[model samples]
Target chain A: MGQKGSKVQITENDRAILQLKRSRDEIHKFTRRTDLLISSERLKLKEMIKENPTKCKSDPRVRFLLKRIHYQDHLLQQALEQLINLENLVSTLEFKLVETQFIKGLERGNQILKKLNKEFENVDELMDDVQMQIAYQEEVDEVLAHSIVGVNDFETEIDKELDQMEREINPQQQIEMPSVDKLPDLKQRPIASSERKEQGKKEGTEAPVLA
Target chain B: MSNQSELPPIYSFPPLYTRQPNGLIRRQQINSWIEIILQYCISQKCWRMTAEGMPVGEPDVTKQSIFNNSSIQRVVPQVFVDEIWSQMCEEGKALGVQDGKRDSSQFYILWRNLDSWASLILQWFESSGSLNQVITIYELSQGDGTADWEFHGMPEALVAHCLKPLCQRNRATLIKDERGIAVATKVV
Candidate 1:
């Protein structure tokens, strides 16, 4: 009957187990009732034999009583067999029900675990995206910090670099004024007029400080 | 017009301010926002909006609160705001500056367009027996006779554009002063 394979572990302390136990108690009650009835009939037959041992078999009333006792014994044996079958059926059904319930719980747990795994993956991807964005923003800030220098400091730095370049290029032609004025417009030109502009700015700064 | 004192219930939902990333959901959100904006404009008699889709009482008024829902403490991002404004303009629900570079941020919310406003003004002129008479733009907008009209407080620039179609059809003549400003129009 594949009985061992059908055995399901019932771990849950719930109503089905309780109901199965209750039915077993009812079956015990039925057995007890049948046992009492059969014993009483046997006792009656014994009494009849004791009272008239020689004629008990030949006596019609005794024979009728004996026949009734035999029928009751047969009925009791059949009831016991039926009760044993019912007990086996009930226990197997109970095992099967528990097995189905356990399987259902396992399947539900597996589905929830899979769903959680998917959600975790989504969260991980989102975190990576946010981290990438933060890294990009920091890089942009670094570039901006490098490019956006204070105007006064930037001008003075340019002035110093231009003075060095001018000294290296030509020492005597420094007095050329018109070309110096136009030097600001050309991209690749060595700084020339910025020296004068820097002097003007220095004067402006000192005036403001003095005022 | 519906009363302007109360805003729609969804105005308080914080998610509405966030640009939804999902395609179908974002389209639905945009449609609802457009409806709410139009309804709010109609209620408040607002005609101008900024690049950020904020309703303004006058073109000069800055920092409107339609895009900023203080109750929920959420501000629609400027990029999304600009998108909504451009969409409205594309749908002919608003008019923008002809020159793309100059103040494209400003828009005229055409809840009722220039054409409809022009027709309403012409109807008023017909009923009031003011046809064939030159009325200044100021008189058409704020004159005592126009006090109860829907276009009473409309801008003269919009009025002139609306009158252009009429002038083209010889239904009206636009007169400008030495400053080249359209001063008045005479409807025939």
Candidate 2:
């Protein structure tokens, strides 16, 4: 999608022409870069054509040979350009496929996002129910606190009545019971797992296994 | 006895038409022409060689006072000269004939001699019309698109050897191509 250059090979002749145009050094190099599999001593006629052009031209063998050499150089240059173009196109297509794959990954991420949003809504509803339960538990605790205060007053009045009756009944009814001031307040020490295990052992009970 | 006379001292001779590929023979052949052309250039005070006509079919080199080898004055063909130059360039020995349709086929062999060429190269460097700066060896051999002194079809080594005296005077330097052709550079 971006501004990419066409990756086609220009031409062997074109490359050589460009080389000739650009630097004399490269032209000199390219002119000598003959890959033709000509036998060393066998290039006699070809060499003659290149050397004594006037004399070699009349010879039919030399003419055909020169054409073949020129044709070979041309074909090789063409093939090389085509290969380069194909390679460039392949890499460009691969990059496009990678972009499509990335888009698919983004789509999957969006699906995951929707599922997470639904889970969050369910959590919000559960939290609301827990808040209502906490409020109901607070009301029950308030009523229990009021009942305990009333019970404590009733127990104090009964003690006062029992004290008057005992005073009136003389030494024959002297009842002996421990007062509330003698009992220990609720102890809130942290119990370790080890202490719990020891208590279960004293009670002759094994710790239950979790499923 | 008058009729005998040893058949007027008969002699069998070869025309030397086929240029001797021998080291000594080729040198003698080339030297003989160099001697002729050097004298001609000096006599006429010709500064540059022009390979103007059809190099392969040239007939009278000395008559036109040009770079034609097949001159009625000489035995080698203009094509032979081209062949020699092409071989030399292909062999990486500059001064030989070159090949190709361009400036590579016909060569300009200075009748002015190598010494004069050395002097001319130095003079070319001194000239104001040309941007004759000390150029790279590569520039002298295969320049991008400029057709100057190098446009004359000749071997690079020949060019370098012709400029040797200039090189010795520290006025020029021999620049070698990685592929081994000689390029000349002015010391200035």
Candidate 3:
């Protein structure tokens, strides 16, 4: 069954390429493990020698472990070669896949362009019609502008009246008023005795009424 | 140096050897034991420890084990030891090495959690400009490249465990052998 609605469709070639890459990774892992084992085995040999220098030199286990380490090292080299081959294979397959996809994409794009060109065969004529319509609209807008009354002239008259009022108010405001300036000083002055006498008289008259 | 000089003053307290009858006091006692275990492990750079207080992979740290205070002639009871390990596991300060193993006989001490360890390694990698480089698990812990690093000489297993978070986040990939043992890692 095919994968429906999936953005990336995995073909058999992709799976084969993936398998090659996985095998390459597996080989790399094996070599690394062997390398670590060799180091560990060497360490163990040193420890063994330290524990008993005389007995260790003649120990069969040491010889066996060394042989095993050597064999693993050789296997690692072989695995490395195999890994290189696998990597080359995977890269080649990947390149072929990419090239195929790119060519397919170009074919699809060319087909679409051809369809678009067929659809746009009358584009120049349509553009000419659009230009004529735009010109007609512009002519209509010009006529409408000419037929409208001059509202700007009325706005200018109002602006001129406002400016005249501002000019008149400016001079009036600039004119100094001696009386107004002296009024506050006059108010601060003490009340005259005549005014106090009047105030007392008024209070005396009100007192009799209250009685 | 003598182990007594390295021990905290509370280790000499005889009451620490016995399990407390009171629930509240027992909880405090277990907490103290957990602190001691963590501190002792950190000081000794001990990664694995048995329930009997033997430091695995570190034969030299036998004298520095925290379970016994020879001068005081007291050893923590097995029950209290189990309680301490249980509390430690619950607190995420330690983890059992073997899955589905309930005995807590052997466990790894985590002075810092895996996330912290992962970040620390990432920081080191960034500082050293070793990003996108394939490094062996042993080389990271025991190789000359990491001799000056704080996590130098750490057990490979713990280093692998610490790298799990990075792997899960796709910041690193672990390359394993045919036996499924991770031998090297590539961090980006």
2 against 3, candidate with superior lDDT: 3
Write down the worst ten-residue block by lDDT for model 1 chain B.
Answer: B94-103
1 or 2, greater by DockQ: 2
Which candidate achieves the best lDDT against the true structure? 3
Per-residue lDDT of candidate 3, residues A1-211 (tens digit): 1323322233456445545555665676688788888899989978877888888768998888888888988998899899779768765776776798899999999999999999999999999999999999999998888756466677789999999999987765556657665464665355676688899999999998999
Clashes of 1: 0
- What is candidate 1's lDDT per residue for A11-94, written digit by digit as tens? 343234334434544555566666777688778878988998998888887778778767767776776786577668655765
Give the per-residue lDDT of model 2 (tens digit) for A17-56. Answer: 2223234343343433444333332376557767877877
- Which residue runs of candidate 2 sit more than 4 Å off their true CA positions? A1-71, A119-126, A159-211, B1-188
Interface RMSD of 1: 47.5
Candidate 3 local lDDT, B17-43, one digit each (tens): 899999999999888888777777777
> Alpha carbon lDDT of residue B147, candidate 3?
77
- Global lDDT scores for all candidate models: 0.70, 0.50, 0.76
Ten residues in sequence with the least summed lDDT for candidate 3 chain A: A1-10
Listed in order, each prediction's TM-score against the native is 0.42, 0.27, 0.48
